[model samples]
Target: MMQLQAEDFGSWDNPALDRATWMDIGDNCGELDVAIHRAAARGDVAELSRLLDTPHDINARCSSENSALHWAIVADKTEAVRFLLSRGADPSLRGRGGSDGREGDDAALCAARFERVSVMEVLIASGVGIYSETLGFAVISKNMDMIRLLVGTMRYDFTDMPRLQALEGILPAAVRTWSLESVQYLMEELKYDASTISTNNQGVLNLALLAIFNQEDVHDQLVETESDKDWGVAIQIIQLLVAAGASVNAVDDWVARTPLHFALQLQYPPSELIDYLLVHNADVNVPNHMGRTPFFQLLTRSDATEEMVRRFQRLGGSLDVMDDEKNTPLHLVKRPEIASLLLVSGADPASKNKYGQTPLHQASCVGDIGVIAQLLDYGADIEAKDSSGQTPLLAAMSYARCSGFWEKDTRTINFLLERGANVAAFNRDGQSATQLIDLKGYHINNLGKLALKVGHHVRQTQDNREEENVVDLW
Candidate 1:
């Protein structure tokens, strides 16, 4: 073998960065760190290694204050995360990386929220902080396997009383997620306090009830079938909380309304849960801080069916009940089905709110032709006026602008006109029905500037290519 001179080996043999190159990287490290972020985000571990192997700190953050480890976590690049961790990326250092509409700031916590199990496993193994908040985020994800990984891991033991105590705050999240598995794990297995009030001073059980509306609002997730929905998940969640000492009759600090109040008031409230709450002594008539009872609050819901109204009345939820504004259930009802139920069940259609707005006026203002017809049939004065001196016809025109500007609003106006509703009537605002309608048309026209907000766009002609003339919605 030939003996190699140190001079020959100086720049080419060892193959590490020279002193000046190291200094140069340190000087322009911010720009290079973005390259590292881009590489990690793309999961190009080969490029990641090449960047980190440069003469600089492995934990160097990019321009956005996120480290390469954060970009890897953001992109769900599990292998890249592992490679970064192995290459000395600080797992303990919180990465301020977050995606659009993603909830948390900590990358590991966001991982738990999104149920990125493999990514979370790599993070946990690399000694990421077992934040108690992260535990709640894990529960919110409703992923049993992810929950198992966190609590079952050696470093993050639920059996550790301190950790268990720290996790007590996770009950609200468990309730909100409606995850029966999480409920059982936290309440049954770990004994997290189900009776614990939330930060808003609301009962944990009430949050479980309110989350029914919340879960329905998540449009991205595919709707699960009833059988596949973990067998009446809402009712089961309520049952678990109640069984764990949560009070079905408990009142919130803000509303002073019990869990029964939520079950009755919200749209599409679980019927089985309502039955469960009532059977367990949930008082539907208990007054909230707003001076409204559960029955009164129930009236405001647009989804209450005719059968539900009759059933509620039979179970002591009286249609005779009135809100703080003195509006009877008949006045508050928006659906024709519920209005007919109340009218037939002896609710006076002539009832008025504190503002002297009669039920006919209420129906007209909401542009509900069915409700207006129901009220008229039930002896409601067709020409009734509110305190504002607006007749039913005038009321329809004044509020028709808020009718979501749909064709049904004009149909309601025509319906009233056909039923002897005077178009000559004027309000205290000195605006006649025709004048108000003209103003509404002008408003709709100006909505062109806010087309996105109004959700209005001219449809195409029959050919479906070129833009057609704007249809006069008014």
Candidate 2:
């Protein structure tokens, strides 16, 4: 072994770095380390030979605890990884020393994941089983060159690997940067589970939802490939997972919402997907972690279509279903059209939420005089108060955040005042509607309060049979 200093080889430059006469057999391990380094830098295969012949340990662990082969493979130096592999540098050696429980920790998979296509090809041709965790990184990165080299050229089984599970939820996140065609390329070409039939990870669902939200071309693909599809393609994805032994009721961890419930809660229309879930027997009443039922989720809609409303009705949904706060679907009706639907569906206009405030109180807050009149015609209480004893008119005024956005119905306010909705009626805070407005004084006049009381009685009498329809709201 040569005891030469680093300066001896300081100016040493290789021309072919081959099986020539310049075999430096100094410190065997030291020379081997330097040989691997030079081989990596110049892609010289013969320099590696001279070092192997010079008596260095091919499997020597470097200072980082990785063997020479580990660093070489990780750097994706094909000649070095191959040379070490050929020289009995164990391919199963952990790049970082293996933990007591872990099995088969190789650096070739890491190289493949990072887009070292050549190195992956070399390792695969040498008979390394593709590691799924490393393969997940490759799939998520969408390194098609590396993916093809691993699967197509090497004949690696995509479904056989357990690490592919990690990629299930990651592919969707790539859409923020990659094209829809890229996502489709993975889905259609690589079979990366566009339907995600195997994993419970929400990454696939999130990507699908986002694709729809962004109106990506994958949405068109989902629609285009709908023939012979179950639960629509969207719902069928879940259904297929279920049929393939995936959980049908798998609630997502982030929102704690099942796929069916999420379909109802989304702002954009779900179209056939919603129908597919219902037809496939998805639990319509499944509540989210927040205790909000799918019915309440649907009720949160502002611009909900008539079709959505009718579908909820047809799905055996009860109008009386309450949210955590005890607010029924009727309490959330913002438009007169929805109010009419709720009323005709037998929603009690006078029913209170958990707050003991009726749908009338919420309608008042909306300040839609038309909806207020419709509620009144449907027998809403004129003098109903919440747990705080505040009247509907006062409830409406409390939520007026902007200067003019609320613009309360003066006609309805006056009508309620006339019907004996006491102008002096104070809530638990002892604030009256007139005082909430910082008025000059108690403007509680008698004439307005009288008209409100008369209209209330007349409307109540007209809807005497509302009790009859309540049982049929389901």
> All candidates' lDDT scores?
0.63, 0.55
Index of the highest-lDDT prediction: 1
List residue ranges in candidate 1 displaced over 4 A: 1-91, 96-129, 141-146, 152-161, 192-231, 250-270, 287-292, 297-303, 335-346, 400-426, 429-474
Q: Considering only N, C-alpha and C atoms within 3 Å, which residue pairs clash in candidate 1?
A: none
Q: Could you give candidate 2's per-residue lDDT for residues 1-474 as a string of tens digits?
A: 122333432232223222112222243433434445545334466876787788877666543344666555534567777877887777666543234654434665546433567778788888776555565555556676765565456555443454344345444443432334344443443354435543544445444444322232221112223223233344434443333333445565544565566555544545776666667666667666666766666665677666777887787766767776777877877667877888898888877888888988887776766677788888788778898787887776565533255324444555556545555567677776656544421122245535534543311123233342211000
Highest TM-score, which number? 2
TM-score attained by model 1: 0.58
